[model samples]
Target: MALIRKIIKTSSNEHYPFSVPVIENLKELDLEQDIIIFSGENGSGKSTLLEIIALKLNLVRISLDINYSDPEFSDLKAAINAFTVEFSLKPNGFFFRSEDFISYLRYLNKTKVEAEKELKRIETEYREKSAYSKILASMPHKRTLNELDNLYQRNLEEQSHGESYLDFFKSRLRPKNLYLLDEAEVPLSFQNQLTLMVLIKNAVAEGCQFIISTHSPVLMAFPGACIYDFNQEVIKEINYEDIEAVNQLRNFLNDRDRYFKYLFD
Candidate 1:
């Protein structure tokens, strides 16, 4: 079952977020399926709506925090306040945004390195101390490093970007919750994207709900999903075969010569 049943925005504001044509025309979005996808061109309100949903639901973010009070969304604070979210069951979940993924990886690696350095310093500082006292002094740093190692077996930097990203997403999954992802396919290739799509399918089958905003045809092809296209004047549910990106990719591969000739000419 879907965690959130419906979302209603009760404000009429002439602001950047509200002024964005798609958002301006949005009435209320009813989520009837386990996966609700937001698809549109960049600069459309796809990401903006994701932000608002993140704020209203208080979904757990990876390495950054966002609220109606975020300075970047200052103009839309009041508008967000007017949002009303109805739920079948309110469950906790994680929010993943592609832009913040790298920053999160850096944070993990930096913290791990600092802990290792602290352990070394403790060893030197307590050189003259008894073994028990030295162990006591260094316990926290050792535990920190151990926990990080368990969380990510090797340094994230050592892993390919795609591999690391997929592992990170997998490590965060918990059954029976909602997940909000924005362009999560950013760091993945076609094969890795297939892996991601499989992961989503498994999660949904295990009773998790997903709201993903992405452009990847692989992701948009998720079976039984409610795909919302933002390219129109108003956001509307769209058929998978009719999605702009899907047909464009299909056309490009089927007639690359025509495209190349057109471009060269």
Candidate 2:
């Protein structure tokens, strides 16, 4: 059974633009697939829907501490809270907001830097006292730098942003959990998106469920993902090629010169 069977909207308030899409259409939205995607242009309310699903499922994520109380998400919070969910298991997963990634990476970098500073301080203190001092040897932070070196192998800060984001993602993802991701493709290149697609595919095979909101045609092509199109302002399942982003890219790639001529002229 799927973790979240469906979300039934209970509010009729259209006071917020973000709430309009769900209020206008979804009475009882079914989420039977393991991989569900919400795709649409920016500000078309797809990210709001992804947030609604996360709220309704009562997901526990790092983003919860920062975003749940923001005034901008107030409408989505209210709308999703009003909805009822049928669950097969108690939901467990992280909600990864791509927008929050940079701050998260910065925190990691700061943590590593502080750890290094502390280790240096400890090293100097040990040298001043005695190299064989048991007290200094027993300090928990004495070997922190070595431990970090062994654990991370490569510091996330040393890699590209896309690589760091993927590292963050892989560290948090676990099997049989329901993950809610918003605009996950933002930091990725074309090749990295393909790598991420493979990761998603493998995670799904291991009993994980994902609710992703994105405009990337690369991500939209994930095998067997139930894609909901939000362009028309009514949620409907769509094929990979039918996605507007995919269609536009296809058209642009098919004849770039012709498109340039029309665009420029």
Candidate 3:
């Protein structure tokens, strides 16, 4: 799958004054990559921008603000609704915020139950026809279903927050789909961040694209990612080494004595 070639944000009085006129500068950004990182301080319009882009592209938008409706989301919702009506993109995409995970897990569990009912119905139909013949014919498929059920159970048993998030990702991701993740590393530790990175890389290779907003230095370090510095109101393509967060972290670790002395002094 090709990367998103362009994002065009036409001018609207939604956020700005009517007299300011319509500007398309926001839509002019070109994000064509396997993974695009959106970095900014809180309330820097990062989430809003992601919402707009996800709506425009008909990609799944997952963040902490999925349920809460606010004036900030007005433009985003309008844009998404308009795009969905105009295009034939599937509405199966979703936007999940941090707190939404619990609800999401509950929804998935309900879906698994439904799937199990379907599987049972199919099996019963086959058994009533000819027990041995239908069983023999469905042996392979039955095994697959059983495997899926086992996997689902194992996933449900994972109690670690990070593992649960990873499980959700593994189970929900589909090929050629757009996934917008906000603070996806919240539950992950440093080591798990590396594992998640590998998973993201693999997913990208499998025709999935990601737009993520995170503060994790480990995630920001993804090779060849475009870094937009909302703190500085500047956008540039840079390696992870150049990120301010990473640099500051490295500096502190490299000279703990100096930092501690300054603090004590």
Most accurate candidate by lDDT: 1
The alpha-carbon deviation from the true structure for residue 101 of candidate 2, after best TM-score superposition, in angstroms, is 1.1
Instruction: Give all candidate RMSDs, comma-separated.
Output: 2.0, 3.2, 6.6
Predicted candidate 3 versus true structure: per-residue lDDT over 1-265, tens digit per residue: 4345555444454442111122213435556666888776676556666666566655554433354466445545655532222222432344444556766666656666666676677677776586777667666655665766665535653467777877767777667666777777787888888888988888778777777888888888788677765554434456677777788889999998999999998
Q: Which pairs clash inside model 2?
A: none
Give each model a TM-score. 0.93, 0.85, 0.69
lDDT of 3 at 226: 74
What would the TM-score be for candidate 3 when compared with the true structure? Answer: 0.69
lDDT, model 2:
0.76
lDDT of 2 by residue, 147-233 (tens): 656655467788898887777677666878888889999899999889888888888888888889998888888888899888886
Off by over 4 Å in 2: 64-69, 121-153
Judged by lDDT against the true structure, how good is candidate 3? Answer: 0.63
Off by over 4 Å in 1: 65-71
Better of 2 and 3 by lDDT: 2
Query: Roughly what TM-score does model 1 have, to 2 decimal places?
Result: 0.93
For model 3, the superposed segments whose C-alpha errors exceed 4 Å read 14-27, 60-69, 79-96, 106-158
